[model samples]
Target: MVASVFSIYVRTVHRIWRQVKNSGMHVDVSHKRTGNCGRKRIQIDLTQFLEIPLRQWTTLDSLACSINMNKTTLFRRLKSGAIRRHSNAIKPILKEENKRSRFQFCISMLDESSIPQDPIFKGMYNIVHIDEKWFYMTKKI
Candidate 1:
């Protein structure tokens, strides 16, 4: 049994030495297409692709597929301002009321004289409706 194992070990070492001598056998077999140099597909119409996003809030990749334009060209168009910024959605509301007086009342309670610095309130803290139990200090006019 030992003799057989020694024979196998000798055969394995011999095979390894033979393979090492043959350098081509160790070369990257997976890189069969290493020498291959193919023509690249050109991207077209970068301007159109770029403008679509700013005008419509969509991505260049998506817009390119839809209009059959190159993303690069679309970017150029956007840079030149061919595609403009979209119109704003927000509009200010004009309400008729004595807003200044209400603000003054709240400020007086905080005692701006004693407290030089004001704290920043979070979320809807300004529009609170407190009960009569929570009293605010106010001086006579």
Candidate 2:
């Protein structure tokens, strides 16, 4: 009657009814799949990987070639959290003149009157920060 009414297979209805009967009023219909059912994850030596120079770590193909491992496997390891990717930005080295200019700019911010008593910076209400990288002034002709 339940199979005909719900438009489901008789076997499925029987299985559900059997579960409810066995467990009393409440039925445990939760999924039985566990995390341990999958194939074991391949182990990687992180120390050996780190020993390779930072320059070689730029591309997965090059890094995998240097370590004698398949690129696909390396990528899988990266996705699985077994391996990490580090990106270090190359900062411009500041010269003595640049350092001096920065120091002078910092000094200029100090309140002249407060310097003698409690050295404090002036309330910088006029300062406006602009990212020049994406700020374009002209349209391409």
lDDT of each candidate versus the true structure: 0.52, 0.78
TM, every model: 0.24, 0.38
lDDT of 2: 0.78
Q: Which candidate wins on lDDT?
A: 2
**lDDT of candidate model 1 versus the reference:** 0.52
Looking at model 2, how many pairs of residues clash? 0
Per-residue lDDT over 35-121 for candidate 1, one digit per residue giving the tens place of the 0 to 100 score:
576754344554544555443334556565566767676677667676643433222232445467667666656634556576533
Query: Which prediction has the highest TM-score against the true structure?
Result: 2
Deviation in Å, model 2, residue 120 alpha carbon = 42
Q: Which ten residues in a row have the lowest lDDT in candidate 2?
A: 132-141
Model 2 Cα shift for residue 98 (angstroms): 15
